[model samples]
Target: MLTQLTISNFAIVKQLELDWRNGMTTITGETGAGKSIAIDALGLCLGDRAVTNVVRPNTKKADLSATFDIKKNKPANTWLSQHDLEGDDECILRRVISSEGRSKAYINGSPVPLTQLKELGRLLINIHGQHDHQLIVKASEQRRLLDNYAKHQNLIDDVSYYAKKWAELTNELERLQTSQAQREAEQQLLQYQVKELDEFSICEGEFETLENDYKKFSNSQSILEDTLTTLELACDNEQFNILDSLRQCVDRLIQYSDIDGDLANVSTIYQDALIQLEDASNDLRHFHERLELDPQQFQVIEERYSNAINLARKHQVSPESLHIKHQELLQALANISGDDSRQEQIFVELDKTKIDYLEAAKRLSDSRSKAAGEISQLITSSIQELNMPHGQFKAHVSTKEGEQLSSHGLDDITFLVSINPGQALEAMHKVASGGELSRISLAMQVILADKVTSPALIFDEVDVGISGPTASMVGDKLKQLAKTTQVICVTHLPQVACKGHQQYFVAKLTDGEHTETTVTELSEQARVKEIARLLAGDKISEHSLANASELLAS
Candidate 1:
């Protein structure tokens, strides 16, 4: 339920605040008295597009806000919690439009996007303007209204889910089929590359080891000669061998050790040097014996190294990266094979999805067919009471063969009407006048009000082109609707205004330089006088006042 609306700096309304209650509230005013200004301001708070001209003459911006009590509105409360903008029992939607055409929206004091504001507003209120009757002519809108009345949302959701799945799988299958030839051509090249790489069997770090071995084999002769020369110098050479010289130095130092203890340390060092030189000679002999100068082994090592370098160049990678490239090629070949298997699986899934969509669509169609007949009968009976004595309404539900799966199912619905007896029924847009259309729209609204989730309904000038007993009937229907939901109507008809539990009067006030609109809640006596003015137009005679009194009394 909408609790309050506040407007500031809006066109013709400098500042206004309205507190609303849950009942039938009627707004009455003369021609050009800004009766609809409040409705327009409320629309702004409900995320309607704002224009710069809506701002007051000298104001920089226009501000509007609507407060809704959502304690009993589960959909609205869930929406607020989902968006992280929940309020304490009250949700306030605020909008600001600047003179420069910039705008901002907020929910519960937290900034939000306009789309989210619009989404939340839909759950809060339903506004039907005089122009909304034009929507009766649109086929899509007709289907929507029927579905809403039917309350088959669960079946519709199933159809939508399956249809979406079907589309996805179909698209994937088409893509795979289109690329089949290209994938097959690439498969041959990938297979050849994988085979070649597998035969190479490159190991990590083996390339560097192989290169080192090749260098050692190539330098074997020089290495062997160098080791023999070092051995001769250390011990094998008979003249001036290193070990013999070290032993003579050790003998002299040992003799001096009897005179001084420091000489004993020096003798120990020379003896250790002799032992180290002998060990070095032994190692040199071992190395010389192990060294091989085989030309055949060297050629084999050279060829292997060359082949590795050539393969690296051919693959456009370093010798170290050969193994990584090989693995990648193998994976690519595996994916191509996997795609063939996946294509078959997708085909199977698509067939299943199509079946599911058809089943759901069939269920939805059946439910809609049943609901359409019931709603059409109810609306036909309702319009007759609204002064259309011979009015007839029908919800024509037909099926289109070979139609593709859609979110709304495969039913084509159109509303047909006949306004005269013995006349054939034609499309509503072709047969009904504007006034008749308004009545039909009203009848439909009355029939669907209980099924609707919106807590509040606003009718703007819905009584246009209606008066006398018909106006009273319209008023009675609105009042009846208010029994289940809050209804606010802007009307000029005294019959309609008199039926409201609460009445408000709108008038324009001017202060020489500026014009503004003001609204005032009418007292009982004031209400009678206003109705009298509405009856007599600017002059309230005694008879008009008496008539107004009688109208109120009834």
Candidate 2:
């Protein structure tokens, strides 16, 4: 429910602040007292288009704002959370229109796009006025209202689920059908590549290891010769090799061992040296023998390395990556083969899904039609009490074969009205007068209040052209409506004013030479005075005041 409104620099309203109550509130004043300006300001905050002409004279900008209490509005809370805005049961919406035709919108002091503000505004209030009743003539609005009353949650859910499934399955079918030839062609290429790679039977790290081994074998002769020379210098078999010469010297020294003890110890060291030289000579011979290399084997290894590198370059990959490429090609071939089978399945599923969607949609349509009949009867029943004794009301539901299904399902609905008996029940646009439309609109609203979740409803002169008992009925209905949702009405009917939980009088005053709009909340006595003024025009006679008090007391 709207808790407050502030307007500044708007046409004819310099600055006005209004604190609203939770129930029915009535605003009444003399002609041209800027009552409509307040509504316009609220519309601007709700993201209505604005013109520079709406700005006050000599003012650069005009601003309007409204605050709403949201504890009871779960939809609004969810919407705020979805938009990443603060949602603590209170929301403030503000719009500023500049003389230069620039406008800015804010929600809870955070900047927001105009569309977002409009979306949020819709959840808070439904503003119905004389002109807005033309919406009753629209088929879409009638359909929406019927569905809202039908409360077909299960049917709605089923339709939504099947519709989504149909969309997804159909998309898959199209993609597979359109790409079938391409996928087959790709399969051919993938199969060929996979076969070619399998024929090579390449091994991981084989190229690098083989290349290193080949390098070593190619230089085997030089390596072996160097090893032989080093071994021979340490110990060799030819030229007394060190071992035979050392052995003879040690034997000669041993013969004189008895003549010199120190010489005997030297002979033992020479013997040990002879044994080490013989071991080195055997190692030298083994090294020379192992140096043998095959020229043909070296050439084969080189050719194989070249082939691997060439293949790597041709495929734009390293030799080591060939194994990965092989696996990828095989996988691609598998995917291509599966595409045909999956495509057929998807097509079958699409047909089935769409059939299911249409079936659910049909149920929803049937249910809506049934509910629309009952709702029309209820509305018709309310109209007579609203002083339209002869008025005829009808909810027309039409279904054309080719009509598109929307989130709300597939049916065209239009409300028809006949102001008097024997008159044709034409479209609402054709027969509803300003006052009659307001009552009709009010009747529908009253009937549908329990179904609609909006927390606040604003009616702009809904009592226009109505007086007497009918006006009193409208007031009484608004008062009853206040029990559920907040209701505000801009009215000239003193009877309506008398039924309000609160009354505000809008007045125009001049301070020096500047005119400004002012609003004053009426006390009990003052309300009677205002209601009396509304009853007797400019003169407040004792009889009118007494009548006003009696009306208030009642």
What are the models' TM-scores? Answer: 0.78, 0.68
Backbone clash count for every predicted candidate, in the order shown: 0, 0
lDDT of 1 by residue, 1-554 (tens): 99999999999999999999988999998789899999999998888988889999999999999999999999999999998999999999999999998999999999999999899999999888878788988999899999999998999999899988888888888988999999998999999888888887878787898889988887887888888887777777898777787888988788888889988988988888888888878888888987877788788878878888888898899987877888888999998979989999998998788888888989999999999999999999999999999999999999764536787888999999999999899999999988899899989887887676579999999888787888889999999889989999999999989888889999998989999999999999999999999889998899999989888887
lDDT of 2 at 272: 74
Q: Candidate 2 — which residues are off by over 4 angstroms?
A: 8-13, 30-33, 40-65, 69-124, 178-336, 396-407, 423-427, 430-434, 463-469, 508-515, 524-554
Candidate 2 TM-score, true structure as reference: 0.68
Model 1: how far residue 226 lies from native, Å: 18
Candidate 1 Cα lDDT to native: 0.90
- Model 2 lDDT tens row, 111-146: 999999889999989887756566766777777677
Error of 1 at 359 (Å): 1.1
What ranges in model 1 sit over 4 Å off? 192-331, 511-513
Q: lDDT values of the candidates?
A: 0.90, 0.83
